[model samples]
Target: MQNSILLTGATGFVGGAILNRLHHEKKHSVVAVIRGDSHLQMQNVPTVRIGTFDSDTQWKENLVGSDVIIHSAARVHVMNDTEANPLAAFRKVNVEGTLNLARQAAASGVRRFIFISSIKVNGEGTTLGTAYNADDAPAPVDPYGISKMEAEQGLRKLAEETTMEVVIIRPVLVYGPGVKANFLSMMRWLNKGIPLPFGAIYNSRSLVALDNLVDLVLTCINHPAAANQTFLVSDGEDLSTTELLSKMANALHKPARLIPVPCWVLQGGAALLGKNGLSQRLCGSLRVDITKTRNLLGWTPPVSVDEALAATALHFQEHQ
Candidate 1:
């Protein structure tokens, strides 16, 4: 469909990728809302500057003539949050802020609102043989997850009260292009031939390529089936920690050197070192079933995991 769309978080990995695709496709009139001081200058894609995204952020003039608003902006999880009340800090931007934006967009005549929520809304990790789906009740653990769950609840209530259609997408770890944090660190360590203890990690996890997620977002722009539905997304393939490392090694053209350390031993060591969370992320299972996403929208991830990993490795090499 050819319609005007307003996008938030244009400076982020996910939002930036979406903006680049929209600019390349030229299928819709696009408006990117970003931080006021951000020096992001893109050709063709117009931008609106909102200094800070919170409950008070303005959007009437910006949302004008926009039929769709892709709300990809959020306050991501912090490893070391210094706030006295971390939940309140997260609520300011993630819950209250998100609802504020949605309320304004609905009032401004926006037809559809696509919210980029996190898989954490389901929980941190799943049992080895189990995966999360939209039917599962939200089991948010930390402040970040709790905040996202609240925002999603608010959005659904808003949708019931307004004319706007809401599409919620909860994706597993998103990787590719300008990836950072744990994914980048993993690649860097692998490239330097760092022998990892994940050789024996038999746990499974899922990831989504940036291209795949952006493609799904674009599809939701007009697909009636996606409206007012929550989707759990992944790469359609689950890999153990060892398998993921091996794939990364292959993509980076490096030999994998892994130690067959016992999972219990690693967990015990991590507990002693106060890194249990880190160990769990490496050794536990967290997967999502996207069968509904595929069946409802007839959409498939265009980029294969191996191809996405190769492209990510290439980008890392060039940047380094």
Candidate 2:
């Protein structure tokens, strides 16, 4: 069902991808909330420029009569040791900012609030051979994850108190064109012909392509099965680090220079460099069960990992 949707984080990576999909499909009239200087990117869309997050985005009025509220803005960082209060900084945007927008949406009588949360809320993706599902208890380990978990609770509570239906989506490691962080790092490494030592590793990890995630988000916006439910999503396929890198190299038409370094030795070396945590994160298992999303909404990821990787490789080849 086409509806008026208030899309936050329209300038961000995943959110931008969602916006592009929505526009091309012409499924929703989007009211994009963006920063003042970032208005250039929202040229053809109805937009509102806001400078702060404290109950003053002026986008609230736009939320009136909207069908869905896709809240995608958040404070995301792998590591944060800045002198500033970390929890407060994240809470301000992730929790408080979210509440502010949610409150407005509720007050505006929006139908559903679709929150794009991270899998970190479930905790570090270790504990190999185990997959996290929607019903599993939340065990967030980092400040960011904690804040997101808190926000989830707040949204649930708000839903009980208001008319808005909340659809919480926990996506694990999303990748596509315009990817960043570890995905970009891997791309650069492969592009430079660097031999990575991940060939010997065989830990399974789950990832979601941007298009797959966008499709699920669209489903959450209107599907009856998604109303007031939490879901975990992935590409519906698991790939080990070696398989991932090899596929990436193949997509880039570069030789897969993967060395056969033993996992224990790599872990020990990382431990000596005070990067044992990095070792755990990079080589750990993070499989997620996406059965609920598929069975409930009758949705499926539209692209294979190979196709997604090829698209990303082409994107980098054109832009970088």
CA deviation > 4 Å runs, candidate 1: none
Give the per-residue lDDT digits (tens) of candidate 1, residues 193-227.
Answer: 99888789899999999999999999999999998
Worst 10 residues of 2 by lDDT: 53-62
Candidate 2 clashing pairs?
none
For each candidate, what TM-score against the reference?
0.98, 0.96
Q: In terms of lDDT, which candidate is strongest?
A: 1
Task: Report residue 219 deviation for candidate 1 (angstroms).
Answer: 0.8
lDDT of each: 0.92, 0.86
Q: Give the per-residue Cα lDDT of candidate 1 at 98.
A: 95
Candidate 2 Cα outliers beyond 4 Å, as residue runs: 40-42, 55-59
Clashes of each: 0, 0
